[model samples]
Target: MHGGILGCASAAEAAGLWVMPFAGVHVWLTPTGHERAHDDCACVVHWSEALAFRRNRAVMTVPLALEQMAYCLGKEAFFVALESALHQHKISAEEISSLRALLPHGFDELFRLATVSAESGLESIMRYRLSLHGITVRGQISIPTVGRVDFVIDGWLIVEADGKGNHEGPEQRHRDHLRDAHAAALGYDTLRFDYALIMYDWPSVEAAILGRLRARAGRVVAG
Candidate 1:
């Protein structure tokens, strides 16, 4: 194959998409009929069993690419992608469900986490991590005095993940701070984490969330 057109990003980065991150003189298996690249990259080719499927359902095909992603990158990466695609309207939950039947082991759980409400890959990753711990999370929750918050846990805690582009500027940051304060005033404990903290330092972030959840439990026990 000369030109490859897979347009999904790496296994990490919260549903970040890319089309084969390898650059220049890339030597890899590209199946049978992948499109010739319009860019500057030399390539070598090898055959794969996945390419034997129908013209529309071959190795580089959307569903097979998703399946390859699942098996190659693992379940979490696949579902993160699934969430991003659903969120961006590149694919629907129904379409994802259809792919589920064709995928191998580990796909069922990924299908479970796939949804359209996830606004960003960061949110998707957070929600998925929380879910593995059995914590129920509600998306884009609206309170009486507060507008839509990112996610709500047990109706007692708010988890807001501010991506760089969304919450970096002074004016936007000021508004986010005010929202956190207002949410706290309304008896909701707010945990604000940024992209780096959530993505790179997940254990710390997870601990903070678990600590808050435990405190909420302790409050319940006391009352």
Candidate 2:
């Protein structure tokens, strides 16, 4: 009995986190409910007589919340939330392993794509979307003097995924350009894309990345 209408709103609002709502609220139950839920509130009534799960906690348990997410939103989005949780230190590796074992439906594929450094859901989106095209991208890897970046593809291309909030300041912008220069000097090509560009203009984004990959391949062939 947590999350959804239970308690996530104030905290998510306070932390400036975005939560995607389904048709209804989510809850684990052992055959109990106090009042009638609202018309819009959809609930997941998992019948579990397990005393621990039925505890009157404030928010839903992290494992249960993550389980609800995986069940409702599909594995791709679940990994996004999972990785973001890991990055925020909200959950630990050992706990995640235990949780994964508890999750029904095989999760080898989902965990296979997980990483601890996806700073935002959008970064997870970037990496997962690219992966569907057989592109392998690693996140938050640091170079010698160019500092750390969001995603790197083919071990030679550096991609920086920018949400609207982070890249606004002139100083940050200047530092990004300097890092790009330094990465280029180290023989890596860099591409920076904003949240809107990646989310809204996905076809264009796909085209741009595929083109860059093809060009790199061509260069290698010529060499």
| Alpha-carbon deviation at 35 in model 1, angstroms | 14
TM accuracy, model 1 = 0.76
Residue-level lDDT of model 1, residues 1-223, one tens digit each, is 3554342233222234422223333222444446465455454332343422534343344445555556555666667666766666765556566677677756676676656887876888888888888777898788877789889988888999887687888998889888888888989888999988987899999988887777768642111
Q: Candidate 2 regions off by >4 Å? A: 1-30, 39-59, 104-106, 219-223
lDDT of 2 at 85: 71
Top model number, lDDT: 2
Given candidate 2, what's the lDDT at residue 89? Answer: 75
lDDT of 2 at 3: 24
TM-score of each: 0.76, 0.75
RMSD of each: 5.4, 4.9
Error of 1 at 206 (Å): 0.4
